[model samples]
Target: MKFEHVILGLLSWRPFSGYELAKHLEVEGRFLKNKVHLSQIYRLLSRMVDSGWVSYQVSVNDGRPDSKIYRLTASGEQVLRDWVTGPYEPSTRFQDPEFMVRFTFGGPLDHDALLRLIRTELECRRAQVARFRTRDRTITDLDPIEGVDTAMVDRVRELSHLHGAASIDAWIDWLQRMLTELGGTVPSTG
Candidate 1:
């Protein structure tokens, strides 16, 4: 996931102090990313400022160092909109965190966008299932190898495929549910 997009999304909600943003990552936003160091957050914030995507004001406290509070600028809003509505290509792995981030931040922004995301995912996962469901698991001993069991290798491969299929099937079902919740019809898997 592009970490900057997450930052832009959060800033769209409201102005957040650097400390508040870090706390958000530690708490509710942890699923998007795990344990972002404070220094890294500040550096990204500085970059955002330089890019004119966000502007910050220093808030001074009595007998303590000042803090930077960040809010999204107009350009930042447009950048975020572009990202939210942008093309999404699924990673090779299923249940990727990027999907969750996009869904969480983009779904509320627009219904059609969410629908598009769900449809794309559903199509891809269904294709994956169709492609992987049946395969030629033929094992050949063309060359003599030491300590290798073709039967064992075949069994392990089957087990791994089964595990992956189960997980992806569950993911598909969940996506279908989400589509229904969004008032969109689920596409036929046939």
Candidate 2:
């Protein structure tokens, strides 16, 4: 899914400033591939406003600069609903960067080439889980602080890493099984 959809999904929950939206992405139970900065959010918000998918209000807070709070419009809600209910079209352009990289190098890469890519991805995910576990362990060793929600954040990160790792493992297994069923070989590169 596009970042646009994710932004819309957040707005669907409630109106928020661009900064607030970035925070929600950081803290919420969503898989964050990277830390989203406020500038990126504001750029997307601007495009969304121009597209009439979202509306915003500029208001001043006491002791603060003017902020634009954004909300999804009816049209935006319809667009989101349509996206959710629409037929799935696998978008090569939208594929993850690693996947795209493999595809770009796949001219002479045959079935075994694809399987190797999957295996490599699985290994990367395993390393990711290890890193996340280490981070979680480090967090656990910290002394508790009042009003700090470190534990909750750690739990979210742990689960996200675990789930993501499990998913990659599952895909790896499925691909290996399929390769085996296909006589342990993919079509030869011509």
Candidate maximizing TM-score: 1
Candidate 1, which segments miss by more than 4 Å at Cα?
A: 138-155
In candidate 2, what residue range of length 10 has the lowest lDDT sum?
A: 100-109
Candidate 1: what lDDT? 0.87
Cα lDDT tens digits, model 2, 9-110, are: 667778999888888778862353257887998999999999999999998889978889999999987776555443333322222533433322231234
- Over the stretch 1-190, how does candidate 1's per-residue lDDT look in tens digits? 6899889888988999878989998999988987899888889999999999999888989999988889999999999889889999997777787788888888888789889998888889989888877876565753538887767777887898788878999999999999999989999888
Model 2 clash pairs?
none
lDDT for position 83 in model 2: 50
Q: What TM-scores do the predictions have?
A: 0.86, 0.48
**What TM-score does candidate 2 get on C-alpha atoms?**
0.48
